[model samples]
Target: MVKSAGYKMVGGNGVFFPILGFASIIAFIYLSFGDLLSVRYKNEINLSFVERNGTNFVVDGKLFYINGWNSYWFMDHAVHVDSRPRIRAMLQAAAKMGLTVCRSWAFNDGDYNALQITPGQFDENTFKALDYVIAEAREVGIRLLLSLVNNLDAYGGKTQYVKWAWTEGVGLSPSNDSFFYDPSIRIYFKNYVKTILTRKNTITGLQYRDDPTIFGWELINEPRCITDPSGDTLQDWIEELSAFIKTVDNKHLLTVGLEGFYGRKSPKRKTVNPEFWAADMGVDFIRNSAPSAIDFASVHIYPDQWFKRKSLKGKLKFVADWMHSHIEDAEQVLNKPVMFTEFGLSDLNKGFDPSQRDEFYKVVFDVIYESAKKKGGGGGSFAWQYLVEGMEEFNDDFGIVPWKRPEMYRIINQHTCRLAKIHGAYKPVTGNMNRICNGRW
Candidate 1:
C-alpha cells in the first residue's frame, strides 16, 4: 500500500526546441512519419480492451507487459485548480519514462476533498477531479489500475466504513474488521462500486466502465481480515464483491489487492512469508485469487518495512526468493498472471543508502524481466509511489521523484524500453533513442 499526504502547486514548465541544422532536416522527416505511424499504431492497439490470455495480457493480438508506478494522490491533486498541474506533470513524466500503467486510489471516502461524501452521496466536483485524471492519462496513453478502497486507515478505509455503519446503528461489530462481515456495510460498498463504474467522465464524456484507459479495478488495497484467521471471512467477501463488480462491468479486469501472504491453507508456503504472523493475516493469495470473478493476482513487496533488521544484502536475497516463489505459483498452481503492484525500499531505514534502493529496484525488475522473457506468469510491477517537483509535502519514505533521482529514473526507463521491445511496441522518438534505452541522459 502507499502512504498518503497533501500537496499544493499551480504552474507548469515550458518545453523549448533548438534551431535545426542541415542534418536535422532528414531526421525531422523521418520522425514526422514515425509520429504519424505511432499514432495510428496506438489507435489500433487501443481499440481492444486489454484481456488476459492464459497468464499474459493481450492487446490487439499482442502480448502486453506492464511497466508502471503508483501515484495515489492524483485524485487529491486534481481536485483543486491550483494543484491540477501536478497531476499533468506526473502523468507526462510517466509517459516520457515509457511507463504504461499507473495504480492509484479511486475512492476517498468521508475525508477532505472526498469523492464519496456519504455511503451513496458523492461530490460532483471531486468526481470531476477523477475525470480529469482519467482524461489526462488517456491523453498520454497510460492505463490506470484504480483501487476501490484501502485496508489501512489512511484514506477513510475500512475504519471509515465501520464508522459509518456504527453511526447508522447497523454495524455488525465494533471491530473494524466487521467491514467484511456486515451486510449493511457490504451494500454500502457495492453501491459505491456501481457509482464509480457508471460514472460518466465529464471531461471525455465516457463512462469509466467503457473506458479502455482503465487497466482494471482492484477490489481493495492490501486487504487483511484479522478477525477470522481462517481466511474464510475475507474469502467470502472477495467472492461477493468481485462477483458484484463483474456483474456491473464485465468488460474490465478485476483483482484482489493482496500482499501475497500465505494463509492457514498453504502451510508449506508460509515459510516464505516475511514473518510467522503474516500467515494469520486472513488473506490466502491463491484462495483469494482463485475466484472466477478475479482476473489476476496482485502482490506488494516492502522488505525495508517488513524486515528492518536484515541488512540490505539479506533483503535483496529475500526479494529474489519471494518474487520467484509467487511467480512460480501464479504460473503453475493458479495459471494466472501475477503483478507486483507495489514494491520499494524506504530511505528512512537505519543505515540507509541510495545505492541500496537502486539495487533493490534492479532485483525486482530483473525478476519480472526474466519471467516475461520465458512467457511466465510474472506480468509486471508498479513501484510504490511517484511524485514530481514542488510536491515535497506529499512525499513519503517510498516516494520517487524522477528528476531529483536521475539514477532511479534511468533504471525505470531502461526497464520500460526492454519491456516495450519484448512486445515489439517500441516507437522511435526524434533523437537519443539509444541513450534513452541505455539509461544515459
Candidate 2:
C-alpha cells in the first residue's frame, strides 16, 4: 500500500504509463521469444557422404571450416549471456582473427528444465544475445555452431534431479519426465528456434544444412551421463527426433556432440563418461549406435599437460596420438566429418608457470597437425574460448581472452596452430563390406 501511495503522490500517468508499456513489451518477449529460444535452423536436411583423399573437411563441395571458441558475446552469464552491443565487439575480434565459427552454449540444466527455479519458466532476455549473435556473425563473415542445450546439469543429468528420476516405465520411452522422451522439451526448443529466426530477420535462413548463417547443429554439449543412465538408450527416439528436426528446419547440418569418449577415458580414472558405455569415442559408437540420426561428430581435448609439466605429461602426449588414430577409426566407421570443439589449458593465471603454457602450446599444435594432416577424422579444433573474462572474474580460470593472461594469446594465437593445416587439410575414408549387417540397412 505504501508503494502504491508513493506512486500516486506523483499523480502522473505520463511517467507510469511508459514504464508499464515497457514492462509489457519485455513480458511479451519473455513469453514468446526468450523463454523457449532455439537455433533458427530448419529441420529438414539432406546429407550426402563427403569424402576427401587427404585430411580435409569439405561439405557439399565446399571447403568450409572455422577457427573459434566457446563464449557469450556481450552478455554476462551471472545474469545475461547475450549482449548485441558486446557481440559487435566479438564480431570485430572474430573478423580480425579470421575465425569462421563459434560454439555458443545454451544450458538447459536442472533449474531451467524442470523450472525448479521457475517451473518451466525461462529467461526471456537471455535469447536476445543469440539473435544478435546470428546476425553479427553473418555480418562479420563468421558462421555459428550453436550448442542448443548445455552440458551443465540443467538439461536433466542422471542423479542431479533431487530424488526425481527421468527414466521410469519403459527405458527412455516417451514420457513427460524423461529428458529426451518429453514432448514439452521439444515444443519449448521449437519455440526457441522460431523466435530466433523470426524475430531477427526472415532472410537469415535455416542455419543447419540449408541455412546460410549456420554451419551445423550440435545436439548436446558433450552429452553424457553425469550420475545415472541416459534416459533414452533406444536411438530410435534420437533418429525420430532428427527426423523431426529435419522436417521443421531443412537448411542446416546436424551432429551429436559427444566429445572424445574413448580417447579421454583413462585406465587411470576408472570412471568413463557414461556415454562411453553408450557410445565410446571410437569406431563402435561413431559408426551407428549412438547417433545414426545425424551427420558428423565432434570431441574436445584438455590434457593435464599444463598441470603435470612432464614430457607429454607422462600420459597427456598419448592423447594426441590416441585421438589421431581414432579419427581414422571414426572415418572408416562413421563416414562423416569431425571437429575438435574444445581444447586448451584450464588455468587462466598469467603467472602460473611458463613451462606449462609452453607444453600446452605444443600439445595443441601437435594434435592439430597430426590429427588434421595424418589422421582420418581431421576436422579441426575450436579452442575452448576466445574471450571469457567472466570465468576469471570469479577466479574460475578457464578463459583465453578478457583476462588476456599471457598464456591465452600465447597458446592459441601465437601462430602455434596453423590455419591451413588445421582448416585446409583432408582425409580419406575406407569402407568395409558389411556396413549394413543382416538387412539392418
TM-scores for every candidate against the unseen true structure: 0.88, 0.62
Instruction: Give one digit per residue, the lDDT tens place, for model 1 in 1-441.
Output: 332221111111111112223243234324423342233222223445789998888887788888889998888777777667576667766766778789998988887778888899999998999998988777667789999997877667888899999999999887999999999999999999999999998878889999988999999988999879999999999999999999999999999999898998796455788877788888898899998999999998888777757788898998999999999889888888999998877777777788888999999999999988887899999998887666555566777786567898778888877876666653322223354465432
Q: How far out, in Å, is residue 106 in model 2? A: 4.0
Worst 10 residues of 1 by lDDT: 6-15
Runs of candidate 2 exceeding 4 Å displacement: 1-56, 59-62, 72-85, 107-124, 154-177, 181-210, 226-237, 263-292, 305-312, 348-354, 374-376, 388-391, 402-411, 414-417, 421-441
**lDDT to native, each model:** 0.80, 0.45
Runs in model 1 with CA error above 4 Å? 1-47, 426-441
Q: What is the lDDT of residue 261 in candidate 1?
A: 88
